[model samples]
Target: MSYWRWLWLALKMIYQLLCCSVSLILFCFNVFWLFCNLAIPWCTLTLLIVCIASKFVKLQRSPNEKRLLSLLSTPEDRPSYWAIANRAAGFDAPENSKAAIKKCLARGYRNVLLDAGLTSCGEIVLANPKRMNVAQQSLDELQKLNITEYHPMGSQYEPESMASLRQFAEFLDAEADQATVFLRLHDTSARMLDQLQKFMTTDEAFTQRTVVISRSPLAIYQLRKLKPEIICGLWHETFLSLAILKSSTLVTSIYGAILRNIIAPVIGISVVFLSKEEINLHIADLWRNVGVRPIVYMVNSPNEKRYFQKTMKIQYLTDSLRSEPHLLMKA
Candidate 1:
């Protein structure tokens, strides 16, 4: 072999090495830049939004046309709050059960937050319980409430049972004024999307109403690729421990809210499930950003719901109206 041939090979190897090194350095810098500039200051911004901005903007609502139950719901069909209720009147109804889901629909809730997640069998099912948290909760519910517990974490909790993904879809097909279902994904959306593709191809309304909300950015990203037409949301939140106490509610809500706001454009997230704190300021920031959607869960009271509607001027996720649902309109 010629010396020139060997030299040519050596140069090619050196060039390849140079390219790889540059790429690695660029990747590291990008990550560092995002962490320093975006992640850290977001909490501080939440404090500002909640403390400073919220004080000025008033929630100007009129006399009659305010409360949800009072609002002449049929024509509007799809309202803001999505009930996270169950069957057995949501008291003992299992999460994502046929009875519980049907009851929520029967009562005219157009949006529902159903716990649709992956189970041990690799099949999509309902019931959100930590294997760790389930046993204790089960014992408490069965003992105090005198009702059988549903959503027992593992078999040990009590013969663990969950509705299959297919059952959930079929039930939706049978329901009237079909709801916008929020599916909480525990794993990769890729697998679920594959399972859903058959339904999506044939059912138009099913595709339109379902929204996949996930904590995994990759899952949400993959979901978008599979069904771009379907609505999707990213569940984002990284919080400080002291952010909870109500004295700091203003600080935490605003701080977490701002961090969430900044995160939207960078990752192309529009709909989001923010942490349950910072109620007032979070809504305002998300509301002001015309394109971004803010959401929450488990609010079930007349006065509390009224406060959210009139003051925060935001929608929430609820479990049960509990009483005559229409009474909310009276005030």
Candidate 2:
């Protein structure tokens, strides 16, 4: 054969091979997608059934609680009202602000949960989830804004600027030596996690005292991958209205169940922070069975506080430490 003819044939053969390969890949992908569509509903239904059944089946505490408690240095006979400050006592001061954290420390609250996200300049700052533009602003811009105005009792408190995570760590170091900071991650980007990893690596004590929680399972999974020693928790709510899914209590509950039963274990989470409304003997027992500590949040009512502390025998997140006089007395 002529050289040009052979070259043309060779190019044609390569092109044909490429076309076939692409076709096979597309075919496999479609098959996989079809399988997922067929299987996911049945899987979800089965998980829902299991979740409902879990309510009736109560199990004793798994041996894993001892190890987790030891890691956290929590006492066996912890106070019934042992509460984590939600957004650093948000009711007293601007949520996720230095003032709020200071208020928490003053009220004898050592465990404070604050929202954290990365800024446009890549600095990690304490931010409110409601602020959609937080990630778009730099640290200086964020610090200039008066976050107190967004608070419910904004007019009552002085204007407060947004605080960075470094500032928070320094404040804790200087003021509350025994404080444990729970950072609920709002930014789940790789850069954010990398910066956090660096921060944790620099301060061994900070890493030891810090607990990272997130509503995103992927964030928790990635965080655990980055720093295996850091304690992580899955923040779950029974009903979160998502635009993608029809906002129904049942759908949300099933989604939460899938995360709790499947994703949480795979990610090696030590704790699960469930919303107060979802707290039940069966669900709490299910968590205990897997050695994961279950905590309820936004628990402010006296009756609810007593129920969780006395009846459930679990810790919780409370907005106002001042309102819980019984807790103050215990302190």
The candidate that wins on lDDT is 2
Off by over 4 Å in 2: 1-81, 149-160, 239-258, 325-331
Cα TM-score per model:
0.57, 0.70
Each model's lDDT comes to: 0.53, 0.76
Tens digits of per-residue lDDT, candidate 1, 16-100, equal: 9999999999999999999899987996677667646533532211112222223212345533343333222344344455555
**Which residue pairs clash in candidate 1?**
46-254, 46-255, 47-255, 86-100, 87-100, 253-278
* lDDT at position 181, candidate 1: 68
State the lDDT at 260 in candidate 1: 53
* TM accuracy, model 1: 0.57
The prediction achieving the highest TM-score against the true structure is 2
| Deviation (Å) of 72 in candidate 1 | 15
